[model samples]
Target: MNIKRIEDTLNEFNKIGYSRHGMNRLAFTKEEEKVKRVLIELCEKEGMEARIDHCGNVIMIKEGKNPNLAPVIIGSHLDTVYNGGQYDGSVGVGVGVEIICSINDRNIQPERRVELICFVGEEASRFGMGTIGSSAMAGKFDQEVMSRLTDQEGVSFPKAVENVELDFETIRLASREGERIHAFFEVHIEQGPVLENHQKKIGVVTAIAAPTRLKVTIVGKASHSGTTPMNYRKDALLGASEIALTVEEAAKLEAVNGTVATVGQCSVFPGAMNVVPGRAEMKIDIRGTNVESKQVVVLKLLECFKDLKNRRHLDIQYEYLVDKAPVKLDTKMINSLSTTCEELGVPHLQMVSGAGHDAMNMASICPTGLLFIPCKEGLSHHKNEFASIEDIAIGAQVLEHEILKSM
Candidate 1:
């Protein structure tokens, strides 16, 4: 692998939306467009046919010797959450570009074509939904979902698509037939401390945990903080806080099942310090690989919400923002990855990903594999999120081997 070229490519991308806080390449933003343009230019130089599909995914194809065989698809998203780390999504794309570079340098023409896809809107930061590109490719995205989704700034999903110069009217064209893809693979940072703690260089993902996101609203009467007695006052923020703890406790009970829950976002009404909060909104994300175990936690949470509503005398209502079941990757591909790691003498662990990825959606269409490289302290989605170039190169080597092997 060309380590210098890989590092340079990643560094160039890191500059697009960079700030002291973190990367700001949120979906449908100008920074994301700039980065996509850079990728397209690079792919064009390598003699690959590149285009942005109606769903806004950048598909770059390097034709091989045989047109009969389906293409081997690899790559990840280019978008990031608000103040997210640079390496989270971009590393996979950089490594993919390097893979193409190596293939060209060796002048080896595989039987199957290679497609590197930089999917758009993989982060849910903007629309409260993610995997937009891959979902469309898997035939899961539609006009209804697009029209319903709105960003925090009140930008509808269709408007976001238009802002990026993509037409929503022809989005159906983005739906790819499953038989057209032979296999799919993605490399990403572990986003957790698992690999680093285990002293493993790579993680061959067995399955990806699906996220069930909820938007909760707690309503209570607002009153003067100083005048209202503690017994008489109704505070929505306090109720929300209790529910958050309940979420934590519920998740803890299911920790053995690898289930976890988080209340990542919370907003309280009434900005004045002198007045009690009249309402609070929270965004809850629960995930697990085991379906039944995850449902247990969800049921427990709903029960807790009811208890809180009755005891606190507050009106609590919640809407399901996202509720997707976990996805298991292809077993044949899993063994292939393990064998490749063994041949390469790379230390790898077979594990399940707690975080959601585009691979989860692709699994429905074709055999998909996800590889995880370690990040410092398992930190991701932050300014300091980092995965070494050497580690990424190692991942690229493995990815290249898999692509060639599949061919």
Candidate 2:
């Protein structure tokens, strides 16, 4: 395989505004359209059969010697977080395409077909719906969640589908026919410093951490800062700060495999500096490899809110934004990757994914495995995200070996 060509393709994608230091291809937007177009063109150039689904997912299939067998699938999302790193999703899809090219170049025909997929809207930034395309393909989503979501512009989910000329009914039924998948594999950046920190080239992911997103709103009476006595004030901002700190402390106490809690978003009502804030709303994201550890963290958060309700005599409301159980990768597939890496002289280690990916959703439908390469400085989803060219090439080689083994 020509690693330079793969790196060149990635660089070209970066030039397409796929990376502004990092990637900015949020789902269901014009940037997404550009990404889809580029991928379709690449597949066509390679003489692979390519098509888009009702949910705007891009699929490229390379025919094999035996057409009767189910295809071995390799993929990742094309959509990215705002200013996310280039390699996060792009590298996975790029490596899959490269594997196909390698197969064709060597005239190595497999018994099963191979597929490359670029799923749409895996990021929840736009429609507050993460894994929309994959979840629909897994038969896990329904009309209720679809109808309730609206973009920043107030475009409903159904309307967004319509805008893309997709029929909602067709997308809802996309999962029924995809069960023929023999197995699914994804190659992604580690999105952390683990591999680099350990001086490893590959990460054979054992499992993906489950993530729970909660929106907590603290309601307290707004009063004049100057006029309200310290003892008499029912300050929502103060209560929220306490809860936020409590969440951090709880994670530290329950640190099972590095369980973490983050308050990513916080809003205060009434922005005036002189006025006491009446309400504060914050989004809490928590993750852990084990459910029990996650539950402990969540229960501690609830307890913090309950305590604040009593101490401040304030009203509190909680809303669940997202709750997904952790997914363990197929052990067989992981073993295949590990063995291949060892045989090929690739540096590798077993690890769990800290960030969420489309691979998690794919696991619900078929046996899946995720491979990871390191990110420089443990940075991702930011402008400074980076991985070395050598690392990228090594990751692609590992993925190539894994795909060949799976076939």
Candidate 3:
């Protein structure tokens, strides 16, 4: 590994964004555009052809001895959550470029072309659409959904991109044409304490969990708090409260296959100290390593609601906001990553990712593997999230080695 090159490469983009607290390069914003231009400049400086697609994803290609073969693609997103850490997505983009530069410096002719991609809209901060770039590349993005989405400022997805001077129709068309990625590789922080807790240096991801986000509403009659009798009144807040507890109980069941359910948001209509709430809403999030297990938990929650609606005489309704499914990465890619870690004397652990990533969408188009390097204290999506240069350097070597083996 060329330590000087890697450090200089990361430094080029590390200072791209700044905030009162820390970094804030949310997708489609002006700050992120600056980062994209820097990416193009660095990639072109290394003799790689850089192109930005309709979805605003930056793809840089280094021609191989056989330029026609399906390229081995290594990438991560450039966008970040509001006030996010620098290393979350930026590390992979920087290290990926370093890998190509290192190969070029060594005068090694790779068997296939290699692409370093910087996906946009990976964070839910802007549009709540994770993997916007990769999903478009995989031809799985839903225009209807995008049309209906709005940001916190009430900006629609199409409007958000338009504000950034991007054409929505072009982005939709770009997504329809999925790229031919022979294999996809992404290096990201573990965002968990597993690696550091076990004293491991690397993590070969086994699977990435997908979350189902839903909004549940309960309706009942609002009545005078002091005059309403407990048995005579149908309390919406009470029903919602009971359902929330039931959601927890359902996920805790042993038969549910380790599914985790959370009702993290709740609201009561007529939110007052003396008012008996007439309506209540709760946001539900359920996730598991497999889609079936997640569906099972959802079914269980609905059943519990059915019994409550029947017995408590309340109206229950719920709508699915997101239903992303868990994905199993390519076994061959996982093995290749593990084998390389061992060959290079890098300490690694095999684990499941509890968060969503662009790699999850790439799996729809080709075999994809996510490499995890420990973040200090397992923190991510914040200013304090960090990965040591030493761990990152090891991950880059493992990535380059794995790419070579596949070629």
Candidate 4:
């Protein structure tokens, strides 16, 4: 494989959403379209046929010797979170392109078709909906679900599709026949410290954590901070703080089980410093591979909410935004990837993914596997997030081997 070509592909994509903060290529934006054009152009130069599905997934196909066989699908999302790192999604897509380029260089023909897909709207940063394209293709989504997804600007998800010239009404057509897909594979950064701290080069993902997201709202009376005595105040911010700590404590209790919880977003009402906050809103994310453990944490949080409502005399209500079950990938696919690593003399660890990805949804339709390469300090979703080109090249080589084996 050509390492320079892979580096060039990633660098070209990195330039599309370049900002002082980092990459800002949110779903359905012009930056996404620009990157799609670049990918299509690159694939076309290598004699691959490319097209955009009704759901806006960019698909490029390299026909093999036997066109009748099911196609092996590879690639990842092109969109990034707001100010996210450059390597999160783009690296996988770049690897897909490089794999085909390597095959072309060797003048070899495979036994089955290979496809690269850059799924659109895989990040929840914009429409609060992640894996949109993949879910639609997996038959896991419908119009009702799409209609409920909206961005911070109050733009409906369907409207965003229309803005991008995609046919939202015909989205159901995007669903692929299960028999047509031989397998699905994705390459991503570990987005955590495990592989790096363990001195491993790759991670063979065992399972993906299921996320339960909740939006909590707390209401309290706004009052003067000074005039109101300590006992007489109804402080919403204080209530929010307590809830945050409660979440932490609950997750800590289940740490051994790998259950984790985070209160990622908090908003307080009232502009003045003197006024007791009238309301506070929080977005909580809880995830784990064990359903019982994650449910225990959720129950603990609910109990905390009830106690806080009574003792603090605050009105607290919570709504579930997402409640999904954990996904275990295909064991055959997992073993294949691990064997590939061993054959290539690569050090790898079998691990679980705490972060969600398009592979989770793709697994519903066909056999799927996820590979992880370590990032610096396991940092991701930030401007400083860095993954060495050498590591990426190693990952690409492993992925290339697996693709050929499957074909």
* Count of clashes, each model: 0, 1, 0, 0
Q: What is the lDDT of candidate 3?
A: 0.86
Return the top candidate by lDDT: 4
RMSD each, Å: 2.3, 2.1, 2.1, 1.9
Best by TM-score: 4
* Residue 252 in model 1: lDDT: 95
Clashing pairs in 1: none
TM-score of each: 0.91, 0.93, 0.93, 0.94
Better of 1 and 3 by lDDT: 1
Clashing pairs in 4: none
lDDT of 1 by residue, 126-170 (tens): 887788888888888878868888999898888888898888888
Q: Which prediction has more favorable lDDT, 1 or 2?
A: 1
Model 1 per-residue lDDT at 232:
88
Q: Per-residue CA lDDT of candidate 2, range 1-407, in tens?
A: 67787887676566665533567777877777787788888777878898787677888988877888878888887777777777778888878877777877888877788889988888888886787878777777688768888988898888887877788767876673456788888888888888988999999999999888899999998999999999998999999999889889988987756688899889999867988989999999998788888888889888888898899987899988778788888888889889999999998999999888888888888888889988888887787777777777787788777777777
Off by over 4 Å in 4: none
* Span of 10 residues, lowest total lDDT, candidate 2: 12-21
Q: What is the Cα-based TM-score of model 3?
A: 0.93
Q: Candidate 4 lDDT, tens digit per residue, 1-407?
A: 78799899999898899999999899998899999999999999999999888789999999989989999999798899999998999989999999999999999888988999999989989987788889878877679877888898999888888888887889878888565689999999999999999999999999999999999999988998788888987788889999999999999999998999999999999948888898999999999998999999989988988888889989999999889999999999999999999999999999999989999999988999999999999899899999988999889999999989998
